[model samples]
Target: MGSNYLLSPYSLKGLQLKNRIVMAPMCQYSVMEKDGKPNDWHHVHYVSRAVGGTGLIIMEMTDVEPDGRITDYDLGLWSDEHIPAFARIIDGVHRYGAKIGIQIAHAGRKAEDAPEPVAPSAIPFPGPEYKLPRALTTDEVREMVRKFADAARRAVQAGVDTIELHGAHGYLIHQFHSPLTNRREDAYGQDLARFGVEVIEAVKAQLPPDMPLFFRISAVEYADGGYGIDHAIQLCKAYQAAGVDAFHVSSGGEGPAGERKPGNYPGYQVPFARSIRQALNVPVVAVGMLEDPALAESVVGNGDAELVAIARGLLRDPYWATHAAYALRSEEKHVPQQYERAYH
Candidate 1:
């Protein structure tokens, strides 16, 4: 494995990444206070990846409102008080030379701590712990779009290099985008792309023109009667038109237990990433069980994706990128000077 595309520099808008290896956002659910502010756990978790040589570190799904969180333990940006704490973490990651991004999201029908979760339809998530969601009025939906904009503004003020909207994993934006969850008869129903498009427009307004925007999407649902790749391509095109600069292609969080599960092999979602990149003509990130450096390299080398994200792999080894640079025979400069001798 030669030092190939995986270790190459990539720039989108004004953001420049040192390598194509990104630390995908994975929630810690460790917001010690019930107020949704990040704590020490998040700081160490992200900064460690920065020091390990990851090019971009996307923070976990941070909620826009108190009740919009997946759980009370999730991070948030609902108030100005939350700014300083996030700025501290961002500064730490930057100190180690890695750019940071935050995924802004709302849990919607899946909001575990909401007195009553809200959704486009009054459906219940298929689980005992989950409650039936109250359908949102058109006005409420518009308000949600506003909340997303405010959250993005707060994140920008906190000094993140980029903002990723968590439009996947059956969250609020995903709920509005999916036919299964968004059964509304009005504008959202007729146009599946309405909510997402509005959300993107709002977020972009709050960001500087040069700050790249990333959207994570479930490219294809895995259940019966669900949408497929074609639908995803169409939705992505709509999003791109709205304001997204890149797509983080992932799949299958909308289905029930036994359905079309995506392959578990390393780089299984690379094809989906490739399709989205080609169809939408934007940079895309391929993630999903890509623990092997060789496989990650191949995804980039084959032009399947511009970046590769490793989740559980990075959790198991924060230095996964540094080790990968070694495994791929990357330039010695990728290894931090103090730790360079250990690699040999």
Candidate 2:
């Protein structure tokens, strides 16, 4: 493949994506009044991106439990009532020739500003205003696993083509993987990978056999002795064996503010995805600061990753895929008919 690769179609477990560029899941925080239901705003927001020519639109992280939400306004998939709202959004996206995937997560100890947060340990986030999360009992941990499965089932019922497990971002799942947060002797906590493995298994059991499943993993915690790129490769291999379709490699979030890396440039995290892809046979999606269309295309062309996901860049211009297609000189890309007058 050349550096200026053309956008093309791809498939994941029977779900056909019209192109390689994907709109990464971004927190809209515009849910309907804490009910975690999508309303007209979400429909307009996501549908606009789809119509603007994104191949796949990964919806924002939706909490599997109410208290698991990152913010009170974040979306939720824990209840049957959320199905109708999501169904509308999915339907709208499909109409524009785009496939939609929902990213489901449990915020765990990182759940701040919510009514309550749960985690493997009671250790609170180090921030001054961070609230201490209640450590979950064995039974509670089991229940959280069930919540993830139930949420996946709900997403399927709502007509989503794929479901993504939000296991990164120092959330509940990442907490279990990080030695800094998960310090417990229980079965779920004794082994750092145990919690995440169980959650993936549970969610897989509930989803349809043909439904594509993806896991978003923090490729590096960026903290001393924290989960590193090598550990992430191991986790990717484990989940691929467990039947995950792809891995979304991301980094950062483990201990405190000092743990984060500043001065990020374009394609800063591409190496994480490349390393994971090289280590494991599973497909990988590269994210982070992938603003330029040509740079995003080079990631796939150079074998850095199988898919390129853009968040803020896509938000700045939803027609990024169309522009990327033009840059690559690929006529197969889907540019909305309405935008034809402007682009032509």
Candidate 3:
């Protein structure tokens, strides 16, 4: 395929991206104090990537509630006061010609270091050291859904280009979706897909029609009796029917981390995205240790996925997409105009 194949722009809903490469949301744990708010570190960090050349930069897994934080320092958008901090970051990202997206989430059973973790059931995450989560009441679950929608509304007010529901890596939404964690016999637990579908529908209902909605899903649980790709495909179909704009395909994290493939290799989890993309006509983003630009290009060129999101690769070097542009022979692809002087 032509080198331009990797350089070509893509669209999700009405949001147009500069290229097929995206900066996958990775928790930085850099929030200001225990207040759960974004700070200059977040602004400089994300803006630097936008300035470097990333087509889209998804801000870290922002907590939707105070107790939902994975760590005390996680960013949050659950209140109106948090809007201005993110607004600054969003403005800076736009200045560099990159679109910004936020990964709104509730950690549930995965709420690390919190006084109490919450989930659909009282099941402890399958690790000895992990805390057992208290089961949320039916009303509490409904309130969490509203929290997600409220966060989406706050994101819009902050001028974020898109909103990605954090449904992956065994967080709150993932806990409800996986049979291994959601043991309740109620509407959410008895119907494995009901919880996630409800959250997506609720969030979508609160957002503007033109705003793109992205769902990050852990395609497999990587443990015996855990949910797998089949369930993921079903979830994708449900989200598509509910007007979701894209799927961020990811895997592992329900059980022991040791159960997953140890090393990060080129395009290791591309198959998950490939499978989901084929199952649904909606765009799919392939993430997970995709370090090589050529390999990422091949993923898109081969139609395995529409977008390739680089996490640690971009963290290691913010100029990843710029270098990828050179490797792909599309030197001007995503570089900011001001950087053109340095390049030449």
Q: Pick the candidate with the highest lDDT.
A: 1
lDDT of each: 0.91, 0.84, 0.86
What is the alpha-carbon lDDT for the whole of candidate 2? Answer: 0.84
TM-scores for the candidates? 0.98, 0.95, 0.96
lDDT of 2 at 43: 95
Model 1 regions more than 4 Å off: 257-259
Cα lDDT of model 2 by residue, 60-149, tens digit: 999998889888889999899889999999999999999999999988877776666788899887786678888999998888889998
Q: Give the winner by lDDT: 1 or 3.
A: 1
- Which is the better candidate, 1 or 2, if ranked by TM-score? 1
Q: Itemize residue pairs with steric clashes in candidate 3.
A: none
Ranked candidates, highest lDDT first: 1, 3, 2
TM-score, candidate 3, is 0.96
For TM-score, the strongest prediction is 1
lDDT of 3 by residue, 1-344 (tens): 33865678988777998898899999989876888889988988999998888889999999889989999899988899999999999999999899999999998988887788999999887666579889999999989889998998899899989999998888998988887888897888877778788889988987778888999999887776667689889978977787688999998777775444423666778888898888887788999877688888888899988888999999999889888888878745666677778877
